[model samples]
Target: MRFVETRWDGYGFFLDPSAYLAELPRLRGVLPPGAWAFVSEPGHYDIPRADRCVKDLELAGIHPATDKSGRLVLEFAPNRFKHESGLRISYTGVRHLSIDYEHSIDWMAVDTVLLDEILPDEDGGCVHEIALTDARITVRCRDLEAVWGGGC
Candidate 1:
């Protein structure tokens, strides 16, 4: 499967459509009242700048407007993987809390697992760490294009 590298800032996860829909109620209970929710295909949109997209959605009356908290909770729309073939969800905000994996780690299992399996010296890539409320998540990947295959 072809997977694209993308960076998602804030709390994000991938879920099968039905599972995601079912989890909404519980998710709301934990998130701050004004927390934003986004559903999109991986690598299809810039997640960090999702506020702009959210504004567009709100203007179109597609979704309700939310406060400018700079933190968003995201889930992959159920059929996203079926359509895209490969899936990935980048995250930024859920730093300290123990992530609920049964609902969140359905599609991005490989990447999430890599967060723990890959080491800094294993690939000579940078290991990025995000301190969550209760734990620290580490991501070891080649940040530079040249490290993988890009320019001259």
Candidate 2:
């Protein structure tokens, strides 16, 4: 599975559902417990759906809780990661996670460090502009359009 890390700007990221499902075991090993991992099917951004995603994650052994905003967050002790601003900050924790992207499109984001392995090239591939904020790190698949354009 491909990965990318960028500053949060209130917008989320994307992930390949197939890739994520295959990497669950490996992800479980690397991700710290209690980290908040938000999951959602593209174009279906609703609280109930998000809650359902949390339940799905639980079935896979990755337990997460929904925050007031309906975001599915993995329960864990607070931890810090280096931001583009060069300041360290505390976040929910896990760096990457899997979501059940039942839709034709797939994606997921995590609240963790922006690792070099997922950073896009200087010329720009999938990595968008970096913003220093409390937003979750968005990981998008390079092969698909991460946004919807309003259609059937």
Task: Return the TM-score for each candidate structure.
Answer: 0.19, 0.23
User: Candidate 2's error at 66, in angstroms?
Assistant: 24
Best by TM-score: 2
Candidate 1 Cα misplacement greater than 4 A, ranges: 1-15, 34-152
lDDT of 2 by residue, 46-88 (tens): 2123221211121111233344322222222112131111111
Error of 1 at 144 (Å): 27
List per-prediction Cα lDDT, in the order shown.
0.25, 0.25
Report lDDT (Cα) of residue 118, candidate 2: 26
- Over 6-69, each residue of candidate 1 has an lDDT whose tens digit, in order, gives 2233565221223333444554433322221222222223333322121111100011115432
Query: Candidate 2 — worst ten consecutive residues by lDDT sum?
Result: 143-152
List RMSD in Å for every model shown.
17.8, 17.4
Compared with the true structure, model 1 gives a TM-score of 0.19
